[model samples]
Target chain A: MIKNQFYVISLLVILSMILVACSGGDAGGTSESSGGSESEAVTLKFFHKWPEPEHMEFYEFAVQEYEKNHPNVTIEMEAVADEPYKDKIRVLMAANEVPDVYFSWAGEFSWKFARAGQALDITDAVMNTDWKDQVILSAVEPYKLDGKIYGVPMRINAKFMVYNKAMFEEYGISEPATWDEFLTACSTLKENGVVPLAFGDEFPWAASHYVGDFNAKLVGGDVRSADYLLTAPAEKLFTDPGYVEGLARFQTLVTAGCFNEGPNGISHSSARSSFIAGKAGMIYIELEEFVTVADGMGQDAFGFFQFPSGSGDEGDQKLLTGAPDGFMISASTEHPEEAMDFLKFITGPEMGKEYVKRLGIPSAAVGAVNDETALPIVVKGVESINTASGMALWLDTDINIKIVEVYLPGMQAILNGTKTPEELMQEVHDAAVQAQSELSQ
Target chain B: MKRKFLNQLTPYYFLLPSLILMSVFIYLPVVENFYYSLFRWSAIDTTLNYIGFENYTRIFTDDLVGLSLFNNTLYAVISVIFQVFIALVLAAMLEAHLVRPFFGTLFRNILFLPSVLAISVVGVTWQLIYRPDTGLINQVLRAVGLDTLTRTWLGEEGTAIYSIIAVSQWQWVGYCMILFIVAIQAIPEELFESARIDGANAVQQFFRITVPLVRETTLVMTTITVIGAFKVFDIIWVMTAGGPNHASEVLGNYLYRVAFRNDEMGYAAALATLLFVITFLLTFIQLWLGRTGKEN
Candidate 1:
């Protein structure tokens, strides 16, 4: 009887433990569902890679304003430095702890997230918004795969050359009008004891940006054809006359000792600093850098020009490259409606203009206006690109992700003389083909 | 029968908690990694499809993978041998002759200061020191009439990896040094006195007595250092980013570039699993050697 009673007691204990575990799990479920349904006050975490002080200040002001307009909703901003941002986001996603909203580039790789239903389908909601048509179509297109809009573009930047206008005039050098003229200018700057181009091959992509722009321009900024070519099976970028010509032009500048001494040693920020400090003659940088440069270099520091003409007149004058930067709602969000509301408030007209005004980069929204006094060069730079024949996406975004990891380093090898252009191109083609085949169904 | 069963089950019960923890944290993840290596998996992808060794095949065929492996192995072996040896020697010196407690403690703390700093801070600080034009190292070299020896340490392809290793060694030496010092101090004073009576010189005493006594400690430190070198990401990521045509590519950084930056989760998983296998084998070897040395 005693042993039987003991057995009964243990059985009861185990039953209670099971019941507790079940109850605990059910409570978690109930809270999530209740939170999703209720229209009560909520805080949505928004993660981004913009951790720079100036950029941080701008977003802080915009988000605060957003909160003021919507009393019930609060945006909790979690910003990480650019280098670690992607890894942080990946870890968060893998653990199912993704933020309500986060910044993502508009690309094939980012598009996969939306296609997999990881990104919220914001197509209908975005279309019904007050400033629905304000976003640039091209900037918005990259965010859409299979005709579903998953993100909103906030900033559109064009790739171009920024040089010190005062220094250029002082040295009696004009902005190059052709590829030949560009080389002459580089040599002239070099002979005059100024670094011709603040090229930082150490970053690799800095050099790739120039080559990407040059290639695009050489092909008449033929994005449509390039997109088609990208989708097709091609083994050789060198076989493309445009690519070879572009590479030759890039090598011409390198061979002339146009870049800083020990070009492979210079970093992107170092190059930026050198150019801003009036130490280097030219640098290839995104449009957003103009705001920081203008702020740091004071008002009358620099001027902008499209990458000097490549071959044909029309191609030379083309936009060359630019893209949008913005945030998207995570589809895994339990309270997606509330998340969209937060996004709507943050990306609204007032916030958009304020962001662009503070950002110094051009707004993708057509209705957004720039503060001229703060962003003279940026404004002029945008105007030049907008009036051009077309805009090309940066190489990282233009090509597949696998190519970016492989081809970029290979190109760097060419610059470092570890491999020739022909060898690097062949290797890049093989790697890309293999990656594409694996990615394909 | 019950007693026999209890005797057989005792060790298993004792091992249960640790076994459970290992399965949850280590073994399970390692299995998952191997599983992922054979699939098309991304953080964003809802559906994972099995692709069957494509990722591993790609790595074997790629030139970049070979280069990265070479760099990783070079970093691990070079840093481990040099760092452990130097740390052991310094610890012996401090414990043997540095009888002034205050000065010894101060020096030890000062040397360990770099290890305490954040990796990013250490990387940036050393980068400035290695800067070609306005860096203090180059400036000091010029001032001392050693201008010819001055070079862009972090910029040059030939010297960048070595320079980074030097910085890593400088930061971590103190950590190992303290460990060695503790191990050496625990050796009985009687053994040293007996050796002294036998007319053994200090150097001979160090080799014959101190070295053998601290063999286990040496093995543990060497293992840790090897693992630390294999997993080195932060300082190199911040400093050079495995660039200038990947002259400084290590397995960790290369895996990072593949996984996060490129969004090739499966390929990166394959690479990471390979790295884990390599580390596991090396650690097993270390443990085996340590046990053998201790037994002898």
Candidate 2:
């Protein structure tokens, strides 16, 4: 029995040795084969957040096209849904294993990765190449922090008030021209037993746009970011009285019964549905979503208007609250040039044109959108972006992530009447100061 | 003597691989999490910044943490009562009917249905039911002329946490019922027969005989329900996302937000360790009580 056991153990050891030998041989063979070739084989890992059926078409096709053009570079693509994409990127960043080319939102979101030395400072690649002239400068600026470019813009989006045209006509009012007109319109609608804003604070960012637009309009886009990013000196720390005023303006809307009943309980989709179904007069939603919402509601039901002009502060109120989504290359990538090439090829005018021509999303690559394929309402929305003052990135995207995390729930508390705006903003100010001190340390 | 010595080590040889795996994957991560709990860190940092006990101090001082712990405590207390006492009543009724009735398995299956369903699916389904505008609750209230009583079940602060608790009870009560049924079945018929002969009524026999006999099973269910209550994330995450400014936030949900959303891994680790210690002490106390109850 002991002899039999020895024989079995020897056999198992032989089998394991064979397996290891085969794996080693496989690696050796691949390197040898590539060594003989003129085109050095390099594999690039590409990660993106466009896993939806409709969205995947162009991206998959573009990857294929890029690979065909660059036989030396092989692109491996992994597309994930949005929330999980953001989450997995953080985990990857923690492990120091970020993908070579990955989706990034411009402004403070991308700045976090850049500050960590994860993202490549691709100023030369973005600015020196013909691609520099292709993307809009406003779309390009958010990716620039500390006078260095970290990413290239892929898509530009703005938040606009999409009002139900039928509701507006029936109420004998056009789109509001100023803050007072907007409040008057809301009060009139509420008195007539019509819900004015089909909005919910359940998705806090959806509610934050009111404060975001109001902040930009009141404090100006530049000062908003300075305070939001906590770049202000330690003594100042987002203490502008205008910050409180902007929040108070939002609270005023809640007090005026502008939103649907139990706004905190409902979801974004529910609010959008209510507006489309004519249960409410207006909704403030992202500009990119206009095409989808209008198509769903049948374009005749609604029309787009930018958030009304606020007269309370001495700033250019014409600026739209908006940001662009983009792509960045990892600093650790072995093939930085190849990754930059991929980013450029995908985010250039052709891809933007394809996006606009096929999907009707307004592209950051200027003049890429063909107005013919888009609905007239979508065309109108695009026209507004072209004519507008400066664009302010989304509040959550502009502010330090930790501060925004605190601010969102604070905003929700204010909207729900659990806390006053003064208290919430005070909490936000404290968090901002804490973040600033940490950075200083 | 040699053979006996070899045999003594055989069970350990069998357990070695799994024991190593458990130590590496489970125990190692737990140790690392504890170590990390001492520090402050952010997404941008290459390494943990050790602040030593500041996170724990924050948990004690932070109102959100207080609220979260309070919510979790309510969940544990409410869920255990429903899963143990109420389920026992249900198990008795169903087990009695199980012998003579045609609809016995059918009723049991209907009750057990929610347990079989995925928590996310159950959350989504309940979301529709709790929806204020066209939801079944408000619709029924309006139909019955009790419209004034209608309020947003999942949105309002007062109702949100309880609304989620109701979902938890609905899903788990049947699982506990099944356990009770098995324990009741295992009880010998002769004891009950003697109780009946002694002029004990149904309630008397149930209280004197069945209740005392199922103490161990009751303890098992209690432990399971209590631990499950503290660990609940998926249902609450999907249904409310600890929303409307954290009206429904529990410790587990708050830990997730602290870790992922705020990118405060150290603070999250601290919160997790706190939860682990609390769960451990509570479980030890429970098991101790169960043993003492048996001795008595």
Candidate 3:
């Protein structure tokens, strides 16, 4: 009896231990799966469309630095190409798998994502922060929708003419101050066998960008007001007298044979290359490209200038077409607090200044930015944004993206002479109205 | 009775997996896509309202849609006329008595190399070859002192579509060449020998013996090419992005833009439905042609 009882006790103890071991394993698995204490270490997935390794390395370095300072948080960065990144983000948004933090252009389409509640609300954090007062009002305001901040603005890019200084000097032509002078400059450049302006319409967005910047001179209006002014019923901005005049000016350039052969086929990189190589006289580039273009052309070749204003009847040059890059937090992020903390770290004065210094682009931060390669004229272009009475966001970025994807292609057709400008404008207005109704519905 | 039961069940058992796959991949999506076509939808729209036929009506009236369809048809017709006809002629030439002994195999393989490369690579390679400034074609033209003939091949609206088609033909003509070669080779040796014995020349034999033998291959190639031409997205998307103002726009790329970019899922689905109908009708016509020819 004693032996049998001892055997039974031994068997029971072994079985109990096995049960405990299995349950322990299950608990560990469950913990890991449920984002429990051990798995609670914050991981923020950050996505951007810029895939340059050097730029990404800086981002990676920042993430590591941020993590060293904040032990509980980590950031995973992914840089995807342009079209693919947009599609990936859209799919992720639909699937509720968006990254913790992602790059965004501050505009209507981007705002749609924020409005749909897919993005984390950072209004309180951004507004109440001491640094809020330091950020330029123009840059800071666009990221806020309906009085709620959705993203932190990174940089303010001013639209301007970026010329090859080497090419200009070689041709012995000074930078022009007025549209007429600009036209004459283009003619002079063309006469010298240099392509005047290297533009590509093959990518429909390029034409829209140029058109958007041209419209800035006419509207000279606030972006929000411009949006309401253009998209509101019975107010077709594409057909506005100002828009027509801009179109005519644009056409004069095209008709003068100012642009390179197959301008439509020339890509951004190639266009930049042409200007850099002294193959083209001019290209309209955003201010952010100042350092990048200099780096690409090795500082000796490239220069910047503001787009020459027209002498024709128009309001004082109140508005500059602009886009502010921003960062957003994903609503579905596993670590919202950590993501917000990362945003705070990057948007701070030190990082912003360093980024601006590295980029030669102006920052939206209230902090002083040191651009070591300071082309005074370029800095002047950047400073003009702060001095402008108002700013208009790029039309494609400001309006519903439906308008960009649909109507912009039509604009390309008008520019290509495949469709009449009137027809194109009419179709675009219809599309804009249709898009508004669709959005409202 | 047991043997009979096993025999009857054997066929179904063999077909069961494939049937399941078909239901999952093909039929299920067909049903779902059709249902999705009836509703207003978007990537993250929590609700999709049923708006019957509204999307379809919009697609029919859309000018861009019309342009896309016209371009797709144009591509198919041009590719068929040149790609198929030239492939047939080349196959006959290679299989002729003068070249057939050795050069036939060598030349066919040499011509078939382009079809082996990835479509995107082919598109990009041709894009460079047609580049306005630094491309090989223009360089050759300039070197030959024909600078006036040098123009932007893929950029101009006048030549973009044709240039694209030429690139596609360059890539796929090899595939058609192979198909035609096989068809020509399959003509019974007895028929050709008999024709030759009757004092028929090589060309006559080809016309009389090879052409009739290759009708089936022609039908098959036409069907495949037509389907492929309709579904072409990668070449155009990678090359021109249907641009210089939608000059090379095809139904496939246009459908993708409407659905993904514009977030008009319902309208895109409607467009897809029309595409499906067109493809189905053409396939039916091919089948009818194949059947009637066989019957006659």
Candidate 4:
């Protein structure tokens, strides 16, 4: 009888232990506090992608300042690095545990969130109010989807060919003004035993940046958007002859021995290092990376040029391959007002100035960067961004992710000499058809 | 009769907690995964369209699915050859008292050191060693005036999978060797003495005695190696991310790309189901073979 009683007691203990383990401990008891009055203490969970110390310093200052101004509101902040943050945010959204405010890329990345009703519609807060006037119009344009504002722009970024000034002077290579000149310069550098372009496609998104630029320039924005958004008919999706031509033009650079050998194996950072070390004469980099380049090769050692215009006059030659990264409020936030206030605060002129001063990137907030707050090259890059005909968002983020997956690998195949431009475009077209069907469903 | 019945009931009562925990955590998710595999859903989307077997059919038609399966098979086969067969041979050598007494422990420890390090650290270190221009391999090849023979070990499609597989072997061979060592040590010294008396040479004794004695360990090791090869993600993710155009893509990496990167949760779930079925069937076959061997 005693033994049987012992078994019962032990079983009960074990079961209770499991039950305790399985129970999710009160996640800060936020649910109860939610929907409370403005005077009541409320905690807003904030998430962003910049976890590196250099970026984190700015966020920490912004949060501290925001908290000081709103003592009743406690901000619980979390951050992850760029790549893993995408996966983490998706899981958070799926679990319906999205933070009050989170960082998001400006194109289809945020659009998918909007379509799912996860991103709050801030049309009134952004457009109806004076907030829209505070940011660069072009910077905020990508965040506006289907006539509704979904996100607030933070930093403006664009790609350019940053060249070594010394190497260019020695080789007598002036900033190329056309595709033919660019090709000639590449051959000249290659003949001189210098890597003409430092490129890496290990992450594949690096390849997508080049392709995005070429596609935007060759295929034009309207046609690319129609295919990217899957609004085009099945026969017309990604079937543009200019897309094939754009890919072929990219391939011409490859065949001319323009890029560093075994580029697919090298990482973007490594490629940047090669350019900084003067092993490569040029590198296609984003405006945000100017700080790193300036740090590595000295501010005076490099000069920037837009990728020279192609001979084909098919698309907007002045369209820059770039976008503004920004923050969005969760649609299901109980404290939409508080979240909006937080978004405005983080993306306001003060934080934007700090963003440029500390991060050396151009802020989307109007007049947030100048000679005093940012590097000379950053200021110049921003000027170019402001002057361009338009901005093309990063292809990997702008297009449906399924099609991007095919396009990325196909681009790598082209680099490896395994697939032709026409062949890859056919595969891309097929993927687009599939993506269109999936999107419709 | 009452006491026997109580005793039987007591064991079940003690097992109830574990059974419940497993049911909730493991069994429930697996069942739920199967149900999810039949739907079309994105991670963030609220809608779940019931598309019965469409994801499964898509899996059969996807070219990446075929390539990934082939890569996984290649990994498994190579792992079996190096981690199991070669490890067993090395263990026999170490146990046979062939090495100098002082060097035996030294060699074993040296070999086992890689397994002790974190896999991520191993991956990063190997990536540096395989780098194109400044890597250790290329530097050595260039130093030997064999520059033409030097290639980007982790970059080319022809070499990327093999390079990743080589890293796995470097890290795991020692672990398998240690396991075999333990198994070989368990056989009584008297048996070897008797075999020596019968004039059995070292090679003959290894084949005739040590191999037979360690059959159970070999089965366990092979099962582990094969399953582990199929589920390889971290090293590949850290090294090439199954890239140079998916040349090194295994089932695990493909599933993750579909689920997270592509945001096709249903399709990923279907891929997960296929992985589970393959591993399950392989394990069942292995266990059955072991049992039949025992019976014979």
lDDT of 1 by residue, B34-145 (tens): 9989987776563678889998998898676787888777887887766788888877777664342647777778777877889889988888788776678889999999
TM-score of each: 0.88, 0.93, 0.88, 0.96
State the displacement of the C-alpha of residue A84, model 4, in Å, after optimal TM-score superposition.
1.3
Q: Give a tens-digit lDDT track for model 2, residues A1-441.
A: 574465456556655766786799789646633422337887888898988877888788888888899888788788898666767788788776689999988788899888888999998877777878888877788898888999988877888888888778887978888889999989888888888998866668776777888788777555666787777786677677777888888888888888887777788878888887778888888877887786788878788787784785755778888888889999988778788888888888878888776677777786776556566766677677778877777787678777887788778777767788788878888889888887777
Displacement of the residue A108 alpha carbon in candidate 1, Å: 2.9
lDDT of each: 0.75, 0.81, 0.75, 0.89
At residue B245, candidate 2 shows an lDDT of: 79
User: What's the lDDT for residue A93 in model 2?
Assistant: 80
Superposed model 1: Cα runs more than 4 Å off: A1-30, A33-45, A71-76, A91-100, A120-130, A144-149, A220-229, A235-238, A313-317, A331-344, A371-373, B1-18, B57-59, B96-106, B137-152, B188-201
Between candidates 3 and 4, name the one with more favorable DockQ.
4
* Candidate 3: residue pairs that collide: none
Q: How accurate locally is residue B131 in candidate 1, as Cα lDDT from 0 to 100?
A: 74
- Quote the RMSD, in angstroms, for model 4: 2.0
lDDT of 1 by residue, A295-380 (tens): 76876777777787466732444555776777889887877887887676666666667777666667777656454423667777
Clashes of each: 0, 0, 0, 0
lDDT of 4 by residue, A246-346 (tens): 89988988898898877888889989998999999999999999999999989999999999745756789988899899999999888889999988888
lDDT of 2 at B45: 59
Model 3 is docked with a DockQ of 0.28
Between prediction 1 and prediction 2, which has the larger TM-score?
2
lDDT, residue A237, candidate 2: 73
> For candidate 4 chain B, which ten residues in a row score worst on lDDT?
B95-104
Which of the two, 1 or 3, has more DockQ? 1
* Model 2 chain B: lowest-lDDT 10 consecutive positions: B95-104
DockQ of all candidate complexes: 0.47, 0.48, 0.28, 0.66
In candidate 2 chain A, what residue range of length 10 has the lowest lDDT sum? Answer: A29-38
